[model samples]
Target: MSQKRNIFEEVGEQKASTPTPQGGMIDQGRGGARRGIRAWLMVLFAMVVVMVVVGGLTRLTDSGLSITEWRPVTGAIPPLSEADWQAEFDKYKQIDQWAIDNQWMELADFKEIYWWEWGHRQIGRVIGLVWALGFFGFLLARQIPTGWTGRLLFIGGLGGLQGAVGWWMVASGVTSGEGVTTVASYRLATHLGLAFLILGYIAWFIMLLSRPERDLMQARRQKEAKLWGLSTGLLHLAGVQILLGALVAGIDAGRSFTDWPLMMGQFFPPEAFSISPLWKNFFENPGLVQFIHRMVGYLLFAFAIVVFLRGRKSAHGATRAAFAAAFIALSAQVVLGIYTVVTAAPWNVAIVHQVFAILVFTLILRARFLSGYPIVTSIRGA
Candidate 1:
């Protein structure tokens, strides 16, 4: 027998229960508790992507040295008055870039370059703010995934270092004499390499969080070990190619040799090691830097072919498809590289090349992720 319900109660009326994680502990279910954190990571990802593009533009337009100082707090405000603008321009005049290269530039002309560098730095500030607010908010609320706090912290640490590295790169050009108009190629490469690394790290984190933690752990059991190694190798090789490309950009090497298959009608460029000290040639010798970039591109493509062939052997269709996509992207990027060289690395074409590089980079990472946690397919198809 059951007790009678109160007559005043309407049909379906009952006490509402509070929804919460089962057992009062943070659960790692697919739809549980971590979506907000994932969204925050995605916001950071988008901001960084914009920063990369803006940074590329900064270099392409020769605007990186517009600001003679690193004013993290005060620099956010652009030149407000004509006097302020003149003050900024006067400072730029002291640098070799203005002294030797841009001496003809008037105040109006200076402002054009000034905005590019300012925009780049402002994005950096926005990213740091977003990270700080999100990280602390999550930590205080106990919303961070178990074992993930340190990973999030690492991103912040890298961002902080990136600011310093950016300054270091700019300082190279600023402190040099009239002979130098840009930062050292090696330092530029270092700066770009770090940006790519940070971008890759954020991407990997997003991929890992796409599914529940338990799913990833289970997927590891079926990891394609060989494919993983192959993809990892491809990632490393691609990274080297990117740094080499940066070197080419740093020294305007792409313009030095407009011919693709051969440099100045020869397989090897002339005066490749003309710069004395020998080691300096790698960074200062435009012909030599461009030659290395071209050779590496060829090697990178060959190795990609090998990786693709091995990838086709994978039992998982999705894994095989990922490699196929990566291969296609690599092929397109190779063509773009050749075109960029032939066109003498015009700003528009060169920027497209850089954009494609980002695509290929991401696709390679995707293939690696698939190799590690492949999506199983049915006998019929994926």
Candidate 2:
């Protein structure tokens, strides 16, 4: 017997649509369950990309401390006229940093750097506005998923706190005297640390939303001993290494002595621990910091190769791709660092090296996630 169509079924045909990850006519696929959050997270992550690039520019131009002011409300506007510029310069002059170090630098010269700092702040303000509008709209639109709104709110709050942290970093340099030209090394590291934190959260959210589950290759997941533990450890190790790299950059450790494998001379420089009490030098002495950073690089490369070989034997698409990407990125970063060293940290190569480090960092994360840890035997639905 044939089934009969009901009146509601007939009317429903005209209005019904396949539901999205959210209850909408959005992407309708097996993995589309969390797409709305993913799309918005992508938007937030894009802004973070903007933040990182501009932050790099701020470092390059040495404009990080030019403004000497941090009024969230009034500071949103730029110094337009000559009087305005002079007033800004005058305020900067009062700081010990200007009186001692950059005192000879002209007001016109100061303005050049000022533009970079101004642009950084202005862009941040714009990002804030965009985030506010997006966040509030999402809540009103009922487009946001259940628990993710709180998570996104936390991310937003962290971003807002970043602005104040930035000022705190800037303050440390000037506190010493009027002539201070650079931020304290530790403060610089903290600033960069938060950026890394933001990037990690963004990447994590993206991964969770975009591809919550994937089929594991039995051949790949089974073949392991220390490779799994070793690779994961190395991933974390690389993160710690990056933090040391930041310390190196902040303190101008490159100039300490740039002959790899030997700081100034000898397999291990005699003065590596010259900072007094061996442990102290690891964090303070430029020579030791650079040496430790290089050592970490060597260990990370060795670990990567081990993972590459193990994954190569398996036929998993994601695993193979991740291994290949990580290996290549790490190799490129190493080469870039070598160039940066030989050239004594020229801004161009150094900056590229830093950016590549971030890329490799992400690749390392991808490899670890695809490594098929605790749930290796779990089957994914097609």
Candidate 3:
């Protein structure tokens, strides 16, 4: 009984002698707020994809220059009255697209092309709105992670720059006389390239956020160096193929040849070097441009085969599976390219071809990521 009276006092004295724990607050590793931000970025990514597809369609239908002016704010609202519609049509008549290619287009016919262009631009505006709202909301709430603020802001800036580039691309055709009814091929390529760049950046950010920082750091030690490097090369080669596709579409090169595994009944088109001023053949010459595109596609497929074989030997099951999936996509894309050439690039088939290109591009990125941070799996086998 006498010892019990002093026991509680002795324990308290012992605890007070130990040192206090250091550090103010523990890092939770980008838990809740970062997850929310990732979801928001995903939404933005989807919108950008739609924007690219619509942009492609606009070009496909020769509807890109329907709107002659680039009124960023005022253009959001389409014509509201009969008089307004006429005024819009009046502006279109001033361009060579109307004077040459669409001279027979009445007001009703004009509306079809007009709406396509309008919808494409409208999507751009909405994307900007989404980025601004999400960025500021995260900023105010302190939701963005420490190193991510700059990355996000860079995306928003790119979005803004994309708008200006869109206008610049549009202006190229608007200023051209009746001789040129479409935007400059190089400008179109620039616009398309920037769109993909933004898409890729957002995709990378999403992947980075998928794992905790400490885990990624630890995984870096076991990264498959050769596979990672090969996948990176594949990524860049796919990018070049995409830009070439844009050039093909720009000059309607895809529609110039309807033969597969050969062009104009030859492995190479007979007139591949026909364009004068030499360099213009790469951009403006339909035969040469399509030939380059087809040759590059073959080379890309061959390199992808090499990369896939290496990827199959990776220790991680998921890494092997990702490369398998990428190979599948590459095979499908090659088949689609043949069909596109055989059919002369019909809108239905051509759009599918374009979409599959995007899919292949993304799968390469996925495979690249898996090579760097492989998913480990346990097996019960000897």
Best by TM-score: 3
Residue 242 lDDT in candidate 3: 94
Off by over 4 Å in 1: 1-32, 176-178, 378-381
Predictions in order: lDDT:
0.90, 0.73, 0.89
**TM-scores of all candidate predictions against the true structure:** 0.91, 0.81, 0.92
Rank by TM-score, highest first.
3, 1, 2
Task: Name the better of 1 and 2 by TM-score.
Answer: 1
Q: How accurate is candidate 3 locally (lDDT)?
A: 0.89
Model 1 C-alpha lDDT per residue in residues 138-165, reported as the tens digit of each score: 8897778787889999999999999999
Model 2, position 374: C-alpha lDDT score: 23
Q: Using alpha carbons, what is the TM-score of model 1?
A: 0.91
Q: Which of the two candidates, 2 or 3, achieves a greater TM-score against the reference?
A: 3
- Could you tell me the lDDT of residue 249 within candidate 1? 95
- lDDT per residue (tens digit) for residues 147-201 in model 3: 8889999999999999999999999899546577899998898898998899888
